[model samples]
Target: MERFFTLLLILVLSCGLAQAQQKHSISGKVTDNTGEALTGANVYINGTTIGTATNAKGEFTLKNITAGNYQICASFSGFKRYRENIELNASIQNLEMSMEESTGTLGEVVVTGTGTPHHLKTAPVPTELLNSQMIESAAAPDFINLMGSVSPSFDFSPNTMGSFMQLNGLGNDFIVILIDGRRVYGDMGGMNDLGRINPNNIERVEVVKGASSALYGSDAIAGVINIITKKSKRSISANHNTQYGTYNTYQSTTNIDFNSKIVSGHTTFSQSKTDGWQNSPYEVDGDELVETDEMTQNAYLRRNVRQDLEFRISDKLSIYGGGSYYMNDNKRALSVKDYGLFFEDFSYNAGAKYLLSKSSNITFDYTSDTYKYYYKYNQTKEGKYEAGDYQLNSDQRRDDYNLRWISKLGKHQTITLGSELVQEFYRSEGRLQHDEESVNTLSFYLQDEISLFDDLMLTAGLRVVKHDNFGTIATPKLSALYQLGHFNLRGTYSRGFKAPTLKEQYYYYEKRGTLYLGNTDLDPQKSNYYSAGVDYNNKWLSTNMSVYQNDVDGLIAYENTELLPGDADNGIKKRRQHFNIEEARTRGFDVMVDVKLPLGFSFGGGYSYVDAMNLTEDIRLDYVARHYGNVRVGYFHHWNNYHLNVQLLGRLQDDKYYHEEPNAKGYDLWKLTTTHQLLHSNKVNLKLTAGIDNVFDYVDDVPYGENRGTINPGRTYFVGVNINFAN
Candidate 1:
C-alpha cells in the first residue's frame, strides 16, 4: 500500500519536528448559578486547544497557555460544567467561573470511550453522556424522540419496513452509528435513517456500550453511538430552529458558521415532516376483525443538507472537505395497496490532520456513501408493478479509508495506531437473487493507554481483519479503571464481530403471500463480551451501574426454508431462508441516576434490563423486552433577561416477550418541558420551547397486526423557536 503510506509519512514528519514550548496566560469570568453573566461561555485549557469565549462581560482570556498543571475547563451550552486544577506559573488574573442547572455532566470531554480522550469521570470505557442539557430538557423531536427520551439503554424498534437499534439485546446488525466521527451509511431493514440526524443539530450524545471490538471494527458488536454536531466557536455563526406538533408534525433547522484567518466553514439545512397517526384501526381478518386506513405511524418526509470546509495549513497542518444531501419520503397506506417509499442519499468527505505534539495527532479520512431505495408507484398496478413506477428498492454503496495515530509516550503513556479500508456495494433488482454484490474490508488497529498513578487506568486493544468474504480475523479488548473517592471502578473484556449483511446474503421477497429467501452461505457473527461498572459522582449525586454478558454465535434468524428454485416451480412450498442461529444469549442491566437539589431541584432516572435467549430453540427473543424504565424531573431559574426551565419526563416498559399472542404491550409515558431563555446576549441568543407529549395519555391500542406499545398520539402539544447569532 504505497510502502505503507510511505512509512506513515515518515512517522508523521518525525513527530512534527519534536517540540515547541514556553507559553502562559489565563483569565476568566463566566458565571451562572444566580450570578448570571455567562455570555457565550467556553474557556479551556485541558489537554490543549488553549480556548476562549465569554466576552461581553462574562470575560475570558486564556492566551498562549502551556506551563504546568492543567484542567481549567468551563463550558456553557445549557449550563453546568466547570473544572479547576490550575498552576500555570505566571500570568493569571481574575479567574472565577461557575455554571449550574446541573443535570450531571461528569466533567465532560469524552471521545466515544477510549478512541482517545477520556473524562466523563475518568473513562476507561463504559461511557454514556447525552448532554446539551439533556437534549434541551427533553423536548425531543428527532433522533427518534431523542432516543425515546433520554436513553436508558436504548432500544428503538419501529417497523413498517424500517427502523431498528437495540443495545443490551443486540440487533440491527449489532449497533454502531456515528457522525462527526464518521461511520453512518445505509440500511432500511437492518436500520439507519434516524432521520438523518438533527435534533436541532445536536452538540452531544456519546454512548459506548460493550464490545468495542478493539476500537470499532466488526461493527463494534453492540456499541457506539456518537453523534456530536453543531459547531460555532465564533468568528461568525448563525442558527434558526423550528418545531410544530401532533399529526402535522414538523421540525426545521438551519445553521451556518464561518471563521477566518485560515478558513473554516460549515453550513446545514434540515426539514422533517409528518402527517402520520393511527393506533389500531383494527386488523386481523382471518378469524375476523376489519377496518383499516393504514398508518400506525407512516407518513413522512425528510431532507438534509450539509457542507463543510477547512484549511489551515500550519500550526501543524489541517485540511478537510465535506458534502451531503439526503431526501426521504414514505407515505403509504390510507388502507394498503402498498408501495410508497423512496430514499436518496449522497455523501462525500475528505480529511487530513497533523499535529504530533501537545498530546499528539495525525489523522486522515475519506468516505463516500450512496443509498437509494425506492418503490414509489401508488396508482395503477398490475403484475410486476406500475404507475409512477420507480421500483428500485435497494442500491447501497459505501467506501471509507482511514488512517490514524496519536502518540504521547511520555508522562503516563498513550499510543494508538490505526488503518482501515472498507468498501461495499450491493444492488437489488426486484430484490436480489443476483444483480450485484461486493464487499471488502481491511483493518489494523492497536491501542494502549495507561496511567497507573493518581489512581489506576489501563486500556489495551488489538484488531486485525482482512476479509474479502470472511477471511482472517482477530479482535481483542480489555479495559480497566479504578478511582475510588467519588468512586469509579470499571472493567470490560471483548471480542465481537458481525459480518453478514448484504441483506443477509442475498434475497428475493414477497410478503402477504409469504416467501422470502436469502443466504449465500452466510457465516460471521460472533461475540463474547463481559462487563462490570460502578460509578458514583459527587457534588450532589450522579450514579451508574452496569452489568453485561453476551455470547452470540452464528445467529442470523428468518428460518422456514425449503424452496427457492423457481419457488418450487411456482408452487412455493414454504419459504423463508437466512439461517444461522445456533446459540444466542444476551444479558443486561443498567441503572443510572442524577440528583442535584437545593432550591432549584433536579432529579434523573434510568433502568434497563434485557434478556434474550434462543439457546438452540429454547425460545424467548422475539421482540424482546424484559423490563425497562425511565424518569426525570427538573427545575431551574435565573432571570436577568428571562431564563427558566421546567422538565418532567417519565417512561416505562415491560412485557415485550413473545412466543405468540399480542405481547408488546408495556407502557407509561409522560412529558412536560419548558425552556425559555428569552433573550440572552453576547451578540444575540433567544430560545423558547414548550411541550406536553403523551403526558398521561398513553396508548398501546394494539390491534393492527398486533404487537404494540406506544405509537404515542395521546396528548400532544408543542412549540419551539431558537435563534442565535454571534460575531
Candidate 2:
C-alpha cells in the first residue's frame, strides 16, 4: 500500500508540471516587396512537429513550441528564404518575416501533364513555374494580365469577354487547361478566356512548353497549363483585398479557410468590374473601314464563388470535393461602336477524389458551363442599313469522369494507369436554333517511369481513345533524361490531336434572311511533336532551353465558294467551309536564364521564337506571334524587412490582320515596386508600385488597309498596405 501511494503521488506531480506553461506559441506574417501575402511559404523549426503554414492572410501560427532559443525559417518560390533566431517566451511571441525576390532556385516543382511531378531541373519536359512573386510583379487585374508577366512564351489578349493564351505560336485551341490536375473546359468561344479564372484563388501555374498529349489527349498539341489552387492549411483563416486601378476598373476578393487533421474546407468570393476606354480619335484618318465616331471599350463585370471540402476518413483513405459558381456580364463594341455586344455566362463544377492506397489514388470530376450572347444595333445615318442586329445564344455543356491509379511498385519503378470518359454537347439559337451534338470520348492510358541507372531515367506512355466524331485515335510518347555532372539533357517525342469545334460541324444561321450553312463532314486534326532540351544548375546560375518541331495534318481553312445567295434582297451569307490541308509545320526555340548576383540581387529572363506556316496557304498562320521575351530583377533584405523589384515584358509579330492587328514590333514594358517595414513593429508593411505599359507609348500603323493604328495602355500605378494580427 505504501508503494502504490508513492506511485500515485509521482503521477500527480507529473500532471501538475504538465499543467504549467512549459511551451509557448509563435506566429506572424510574410509579405513581398509589393506587400502581397505570399502563400506556399514554408515555415518550420529545426526539428519539431510544431510548424505551420501561413494562412491566406500570410499569418502563421505555431503551437506547443518549447520555450527556448530556436531558429525559424520561411521560404517561397522565386524568392529568397528567410532564417532568424528568436527567443521564445512564456507568453505568445511574434516572429515576422519578409522575403525578397530572387532568381535562385525559385524552389519550384512542376506538374507537366501526365500526372508526373518533378523538380524543375529534373523534369523530362521543359516546364515553367510562376509563383506568387512573379504574379505580383505584373500587377495584373486578372489571370490574363498575370500571364504577360510570368510566361515568356505565352500571348494573352484579355478583352471584356474573356482572355485567350497562345504558346509557341500555336492556336489557342491547341493547348490544354487544368485546375489542380483536373480538366477545366473553358467557354465555347474560340479562346479559353483565362480572365474568367480568379487569380486570388490560385497558388501557382505550371506550364509545359511542348506537346503533352501523352496524358492530356486532344487540345494538347501545343502545350499544357495547370493552375494549382490554394489548399487548406490553417485552423481558421480569412482574407480580403480591394483594388482601384486606372480606367475606372475595380477588383475585390475575399476568402475564408479552415483546416485541421480530420476536416478542412475553404470558401472564396470575388468581383471585378471595368468601365472600358475609348479610341475614336486614333481611327480618324484614311480607310472607309475606320469610323471617326468609333468609340469602344471592352467593359465587363464578373463574380465567382467557390467552396472546397476535404475529409480524412482514415490513415490510408481520404476524400475531397469542391464546387464553384462563376458568372460574367460582358459588353463589347463589336461590328459597330455603341452597338453593344452583350454576353452572360454561367458555369459550375463539382469533383471528388479518393485515396486508394499510400501510393495510389482515384478521382471523379465533372463541370458544366452555359452561356449566351445578345447584340443590339442602333440606327446608322447611312440608309444602307449595314448595321445588322442579331441575338446569338449558345449552350455548351461537358461532363467528364476519370479514374487514375498510381503505384510505386519498386525503388526504381513508378507506374500510372488512367481512364477517362467525356461527353460534350453544344447547341446554338439565333435566327434559327441549331440541333445539339453529343461527342463522347473514352480514353485509356498507361505510363511507366523507370530509373534506368543512377543518373539516367526513362519515361514511356501510350494513350488510346475512341471518340464519336473521330473514331479511334492512338498517341504514344517516349522521353529520357540523362544527368551528366552539373548538366541534364532531355529528349522527348509525342503525338497529339485536336477535335473539331461544334461550330465547324453543325452550325447554321439566317442573317437578314440569308441562310448560312455548316459542314456536316469534318475531320479531327492530328500532330506529331518532338522536343530536345537541356538544363544546367549551379550555385549562382541556372539555365534551360528547348528546341521543338510539330508536324500537323488536316489543317482547317475557310475557302471562297461559288454558291451564291438565292434571295437577292438579303445580304450574302459569308460561307466558311471546312476542308483539310495536306500538311502544316511549326518549329520553335525557347531559352531561360536565372542569375543570382552579389549583394542580395537576382535576375532572370526568358525568350521564345516560333515560325509556323501552312503548306496550302504558304503563309504564316493568323494570330501567331513570332517572338516573345520577359525579364525581372529584384533586391531582398530580410533582416530589414525591405525589398525592391523591376520587371520588363516584350512581344513582337510582324504579320497583321483584323484578327492579328495587335501584332507589332516588339515593345517593352517596365514596372517597379518596393516595400518598407514599419519602424515601430513588423506587423504593418507599406508597398509602392508603378509601371509603364508600352513605356514608349509608340503608335504604329495598324493593318487597317489605310487607316492609322491605335495605341496600347500608357502608364499605371498602385500602392498597397498589408497588416497581420495574430497570436
Candidate 3:
C-alpha cells in the first residue's frame, strides 16, 4: 500500500511539472433576450469536460484552457442553447451571449441513468431531477424527507429501527445511494444514514428508477440516487445557516471555500439536535392499556464535518482528497430501559483524473468507511456506571477502489468502462457468534450511448460481478428514446442481481421472544425489470407518466423453522432463519403534471399507485402503500433588492400493509413555507425562512413496535437564516 501511494504521488507530480507551461482563460456573461442577467446558466467548451455555471451576477470564467479555437456553448432550462466559436492565443478572452425563451426541455442535463451525461430531452432513459430551489422550498431537514416531498415514486416512514424508504414499492435494501458518484457504505437495519448528508451543501439530486445494476452494482435493483454537491469558483467564499424549531430542535451548518488556478479547497461543518417527543404515554399490551417507557424520535443528536481539496495539475489532469466524520446519539426514556444507542462513522477518499483529450478522461478513486456502535448503560455499581462493561456492540468497515474511463467515440456515440473492488469486514459482540467476518466483491461494467437517427437514441450496458462466496453473475440493460415535436417516448428493460449481505449470512440474535439465525447457503436474489414513460414539455405545461414492473426470484426472507442441528438454549419460543424461499413482483404507475400559471405562480402535483405482492405466499408485501400522492403550489416575487417566495405542500397516502402487524391508517399532511431574501448584492447575501409542518397537528399514537400511519410530532414551527459572502 505504501509503494502504491508513493507511485501515485510521483506520477501526479511529474504530470504537473511537465504540463506547467502556458495556459489561457475565458470569461463571459450570459443574459436573456430582454438583457436580464441569467443566473445558474451552464457554459462549457463544446465536447469537453471544461465547464462552469454562471454566478449570481451572470458572470463565469473558465481557467486553464489550452490555447486553441473551440466552440463555447451556453444553456439553461426553458431556453434555447447558444453556441459560438472563439480563438485563444495566450491571452484572456471575454465574450457576451444572450438566449431566448423556448418551449422545450432540451437544455436540462442528467448523468445517473446511463453513467454518462446527456440532455434530459434526448436521454434514452427516464430520470427525475430536483434542483436546489425546489429542495429549499420544501424546507426538509434531511435527504429522505426531501426526496419524499418532491417525487411521487418515493416514500419514507420513521421508526426505531430507522427511516424506512420505499422506491416504487421496493425497500431500501434494493436502492443504491451515491454522494458525488461514490457509494455510501454504512447501514443499520437496511437503512443508510440519510442524516449524514447536509442539505445546504447539495446543488442537485438525480433519480433513476428501475434496475440500474448494469451501471452500478448490487442494491441497485430498485433505483439509484446521485447527490451532487456545490463547488466554488471564486477566490474565497463562505456561508453560514442556522435553524431553530419546536421541541427545542436546532440545526446549524457552516461552509468555507478557497479556489485558485492550481488548487481549490472546501470545508463544511454541521450539527443537529432535538429534545425528542412522544405522541402517547400508553400502549395496548394484549387487551389493557399499559404505561409506555420509550420516547419517539425520528432522530436525536447528530454532528458531521467534512473537508476536500483539489489540485488542478493542468488543463488535462487533476487530483483530489477528502475526509468526513459523523456521530449520532439516541437516548431512550428514563423509565425502565437502562441503555441507549450511539453511532459513529469515519470516511476518507482520494482520487485522480487524467483528461486524455477534450472528449475523454480516466479516473481512479479509493475510499474507506468505518462504522461503530456503542451501548450506554445508565446503571451504577460501586460508585461508577456499568457502561464500561458492555460499551462496544458492533464495528464494521469497508474499503472500495474504482477506476473508470469515458471516451467519446465520435459525434454520435460515447462509451464508458469502469471497474470496482470492495472489501468489507464486520465484528459484533451481540449480533454474531464469531469474532469477525469478511467479504469481497469485484465487478466490471461497460456502457454505450449512440445517437441512432436524427431524433432517436439507444443505450446499452452490461456488468459482470465476482463475489467470493457466490461465484460470478452478469447483468445487462437496454433502453431507447424517440423525440417527437413536443414529446419524448422512452422504454427500458434490465436484469438485476443482489448478493446476500454479510449480516444476513452470519447474524445471530434474540429479540421480543423470537430467535433469529442467518443461513450461509443462501442464493442471490435475481430480478427482471421493465419500464416505459412519456414526457411532454411546452411553454406553460410539463407532464410525465411512467409504468414499471419488476419480477424477482429467490427473494430473501425470514421464516419460522424447527431448531437447528446444534442449537443452544436461549429464552425464546420461536426460531427463525433467513432463507431464499420467496418470489415477488411489484408493479406501479406514476403520473405527474406541472403547470406555470400567471403572475409568477406555479402549481404541480403527482400520484403513484403500486401493487407489490408475494407470488409464492399469495400476500401483499409489507410496509407498502397502494396509493400515495403530493401537491405543491408556489408564488415568487422579485424586486430591485430582494425576493419573496411562498409555498404550500401537501401529501396523502392510503393504508400501509404489514404481515405480522395490523394495517396502518391512511393520513394527510400539510406544510407551509415562506422565504424572504434580505440582501442580494454581488458579494453578500442574506435570507430568512419560516415554515409550519403538520399544520393540522395530526399524530399517530400507536405503540413503538407497530406500524405508524404518520410519525410527525404534531404541529411544529421553525425559522431559519442563511448568510453568504464571497470575494
Candidate 4:
C-alpha cells in the first residue's frame, strides 16, 4: 500500500509539470451600480478554487493563468453576483465589473447530487437548498433545529439513546453528513451529534434525497446533507458573534482570517452552554416495558476549535491542511448516581489539488478522526478512580486516503474517477467481548456527464467496493434532465449498499439494564431508489414537486432471542440479539413553492407525505412521522447604510409511529426573528438580531415514559450581536 501511494504521487507531479505552459495574469476592479469602489469584495474564476479579495483600491489580480476561455465571477454580501466570460490569450491590464444590489438565492450554485457543480435549477437530481439568507432569517441555535424548521422532509425527536433523526423515513444509519465534501464521522448510538458543526459559520446547506451511493459511497441510501462553510477572502478579516437566550443558554463564535501572496489561514472557536429544562419527572422501577428518566433533558456544555491553512503553489498546484478539537460534557443531575457523560473528538485532514487546465483537475486527500466516550464521576468513589475521574467506555477511529482525477473528454462530456482506501478501528474497555477490532476496505468509482444539447444532459456512474469481511459489492445510477423555457424535468434511478459495522458484528453491551449481543452472520443491507421531479423557475415565482420510493432488503435490527445451554456466560434473561428483517420500504412525495410579493415581501412553504413500512411484519417503521409541513414569510427593506429584515417560520407534523415504544403526538411550533444592519461598509459591519421561539408557549408535557414530539420548554426570547472588520 505504501509503495502504491508513492508511485501515484510521482505520476501526479509528473503530469502537472509536463502540462506547464505560458502564464498570463488578469487584473480587474469591482464596483457598485453607482460606480463606487466595492472594496473587500471577492473575485475568482468560476468552477475553480483560485480566488482573491479586492484591496482598498477595489483592484484584484490573479496570476499564473494559462491561455484559455474562462468565466470570472465576483461576489459581495449585499450585491448581486457578477459573472462574465473572457478569453485570456494575453495578459489583460484592466477589466471593470459593475454589480447590482439584491439578495436572492434562486441563481445560487449547488453541487451535492453529483460530484460536479451545477446551478440549483439545472441539477439533474431534485435538490433542496438552504442558503445563507434563509439561515440568517431562521436564526436557529444548532444544525438539528435548523433542519427541523427549514426542511419539511426532515424529522427529529429526542431519545434516551440519542436524538432520533430521519430523512423521509430512513434513520441515521442510512444517511451521511459531509462538511465541504468531506465526511465528518460515523454515528454513535444510531444517531449523530450534529452539534459538532458550527451553525454560525455555515454558508449553505444542500440536501439531495434518495440513494447516492454511486457517487458518495456507503451510508447514502437515505440522502446526503452537505454543509458548505464560509470562506473570508481578505488581507485580514475578523468576526465575532454572541447570543443569549432562555434556559440560561449562551453561545459564542469567533473567527479570524488572514491571507498573503501565497498563503491563506482560517481559525474558528465556538462554545455553547445550556441549563436544560424538563416538563415531566418520572422513573421506571422494574418489570416494565417502558424506559423513563428522572429528567426529560440533560444540561450540556460543548466547545470546539478549528484551524485551516492553504498554500497556493503557483496556482497550478495547491495543498491544504486543517485540524479540529471538540469536547462535550453532559450533566445528568440525579440523586442516586452522581455521574455524567463525557465526549472528546480530534480530527485532521490534508489534501492537494493539481489543475490540468481550466476545465479539469486532480485531487489527493487524507483524513483521520478519533472519538472517545467516557463516564465522569462527580464525587469521590472507592474504585480505581477519584472525583472528576474519567472511565473510558468506547473509542473509535477512522482513516481514509483518497485520490481522484477529473478531465474533460471533449466539448460535450466530462469524466471523473477516484479510488479510496479506508481503515476503521474500534476499542472498548468493557462493552465488547473482544478488546479491539478493525476493518479495511478499498473502493473505486467512475462517473460521466454528457451535455447532449444546450438544455439537456445525462449522467451515469458506478462504484465497486471490496470489504475484508463482506467481500465485494457494486452500485450504479443513471439520471437525466431536460429543460424547456422555464420548466425542468428530471429523473433518476440508483442502488445503495451498506456493510455491517464492527459494533453490530462483534460487540456486546448493557443498555437500560439489558444485555445486547452482536451477530457475526448478519447480512449486508441493500436498497433500490427511484425518483422523478419537475421544477419551474422564473423572476417572481419558483415551485418544485418530487416523488421518490426506496426498497431495502436484509435490514438489520435487534430482537429477543433465547439462549442455548452452551451460552452460559451469555445470560438468558433480559437479552437481545441482532437479526435481519428481510424486506422494508419507504415512499414519499414533497411539494414546495416560493413567490415574491409586492412591498418587499416573500412567502414560501413546503409539504411532505411519507409512508414507511416493514413488509415482513406489515407494520410502520419506528419513530417515523407520516406527514409534515412548513411555512416561511419574510420582509426586507434597505435605505442609506442600513438594511432590515423580519422573518417568521412555522412547522407542523403528524403523529409518529413506533412498534415497541409509546407513539409521539404531533405538534406545532413557530418562531419570529428580526435582523438589523446597523452599519454596512467595505471596512467594517455590525448586525443585531432578536427572536422569539415557540411563540404559542407550546410544550410537550407528556410523561417521561412516553415519546414527545419536541422538547421545547415554551416561549423563549433571545438577542444576538455580530461585528465584522476587514481591510
- Number of the predicted model whose TM-score against the real structure is largest: 4
lDDT of 4 by residue, 1-727 (tens): 6468657766765654544689899998999999999888889986566789998778999887778889999987656678899998999988999988753555676788877766677776667899888887888887777888888999987754357688999988788888888787755565687768877888899998877535678558899989988778989999998888998877889999998868999999999888877776655545444444556667889899999999877666778999999988888766636688788889999888888777889888888989888888887768656879888888989898888888887777888899988899999866776789999988899888888879888888888989999899888888888998989998989898888888888888766556788898999999999999888887788998989999999887778886656455653346788888899999999999898898999999899999999899999888888999999999989989889999899999988997887788899999999999999887889999999999999988876666788888889999999899987
Tens digit of lDDT per residue, candidate 1, span 539-637? 899998988888888878777755656765675656777888878888878999989999998888999888889888888777778888889989999
Candidate 3 on 66-114: residue-level lDDT in tens? 7778889887756777889888786554588898875334466678887
Q: What lDDT would candidate 2 get against the real structure?
A: 0.64
TM-score list, all predictions: 0.34, 0.79, 0.93, 0.94
User: Comparing 1 and 2 by lDDT, which wins?
Assistant: 1
lDDT of 1: 0.79
lDDT of 2 by residue, 296-326 (tens): 3466777878777776543333456677766
Those runs of model 3 whose alpha carbons end farther than 4 Å from true positions after fitting are: 1-22, 37-64, 73-83, 89-92, 99-106, 284-288, 381-390, 562-570
Best by lDDT: 4
lDDT rank order: 4, 3, 1, 2
Q: Please identify model 2 stretches exceeding 4 Å from their true place.
A: 1-103, 157-164, 280-296, 332-352, 371-392, 431-433, 508-517, 566-568, 648-666, 673-688, 699-711, 720-727
